[model samples]
Target: MDFLRWTLIFLVLALVSAALGFGGFAADFAYIGKILFFIFLVLFIVGLIFGRGRGRTL
Candidate 1:
């Protein structure tokens, strides 16, 4: 969740920086956002895979 939040923050920053014509800062923010997004994806997938059937009534 935090990763996702930071990803969104960086992405928004990248958009804002680009709009303000700060090309270098925008690129760096975009890169960080991309990395955080991927990490969030991997973590989400791992959680889905390992978090099966915890409260089954068997």
Candidate 2:
């Protein structure tokens, strides 16, 4: 949940930075967004892996 929140924040920051022509800031936020996205992806995959073993799948 926290990761998703930060990811969304960084994504919005990246977009705003890009629109404002803050290339460095945009890149930084983009990088952060990518990291957070991957973190969420991994968590999701892990959840799926464990989820399938249980009767309740998310």
Candidate 3:
């Protein structure tokens, strides 16, 4: 959850920086955002696969 949030923040920052003409900062932020997104995606998939059998009792 936190990871996703940061990824979004970075992406937004990247866009804003690019609009402001801060090419270097924008590129760096974009790269970081992309990496974070991939990490979050992998974690989500892993959770789905491994965290699926521990809920509720009838």
Candidate 4:
């Protein structure tokens, strides 16, 4: 969750920086955002696979 939020934040920052003509900063932010998003995706999938059937009590 936190990783996803930071990914989005960095993506937005990258877009804004690109719009403002800061090419180097934009590229760096975009790269970092992409890496974070992938990490989030992998973690989410792992959780889904390994964390099933534990939400209720008998």
Candidate 5:
């Protein structure tokens, strides 16, 4: 849920930046968006790993 919210916010920001013709700002926002995307991916993978591990009774 949090990831979805952040992703939406990032997309909005990217769109706004692009519309404003701020290439540097747009690039920065894009970089942030990429980072956030990776973070979300990592969180999802960790959750999956832990969830599966939980069922295995470590």
Candidate 6:
């Protein structure tokens, strides 16, 4: 969740910076956001796989 939050924050910052014409900063922020998003995706997948094996009740 934190990764997703940071990914969104950086993505929004990237868009805003790009709109304001800060090309370099926007690229960096976008790169960071992309990486964080992937990390979140991988973690979510792993959690789903392992979590299903637990068979815990809600």
Which one wins by lDDT: 2 or 4?
A: 4
User: Of the pair 3 and 5, which is ahead by lDDT?
Assistant: 3
lDDT (Cα atoms) of all candidates against the true structure: 0.97, 0.93, 0.97, 0.97, 0.81, 0.98
Q: Which wins on TM-score, candidate 2 or candidate 4?
A: 4
Q: Which candidate is the best by TM-score?
A: 6
Positional deviation of residue 47's Cα in model 5 after best superposition, in angstroms: 0.3
Off by over 4 Å in 3: 55-58
| Residue-by-residue lDDT tens digits, candidate 6, 1-58 | 8999999999999999999999999999999999999999999999999898887689
TM-score, model 1 to reference: 0.91
Angstrom error of the Cα, residue 31, model 5: value is: 0.4
Q: Determine the backbone clash count of candidate 4.
A: 0
User: After aligning candidate 5 to the native by TM-score, how far in Å is the CA of 16 from where it should be?
Assistant: 1.3
Instruction: Name model 1 segments beyond 4 Å from true.
Output: 56-58
Candidate 2 Cα errors over 4 Å, as ranges:
none
TM-score of each: 0.91, 0.84, 0.89, 0.90, 0.74, 0.94
> lDDT by residue for model 5 over 11-44, one digit each (tens)?
7888899998988888877788778888888999
Q: Candidate 6 overall Cα lDDT vs. reference?
A: 0.98
Instruction: Give lDDT tens digits, candidate 4, residues 1-58.
Output: 9999999999999999999999999999999999999999999999998889578668
lDDT of 2: 0.93
* The best candidate in terms of lDDT: 6
| Winner on lDDT (2 vs 6) | 6
What lDDT would candidate 3 get against the real structure? Answer: 0.97
lDDT by residue (tens digit), candidate 1, 1-58? 9999999999999999999999999999999999999999999999988888466677
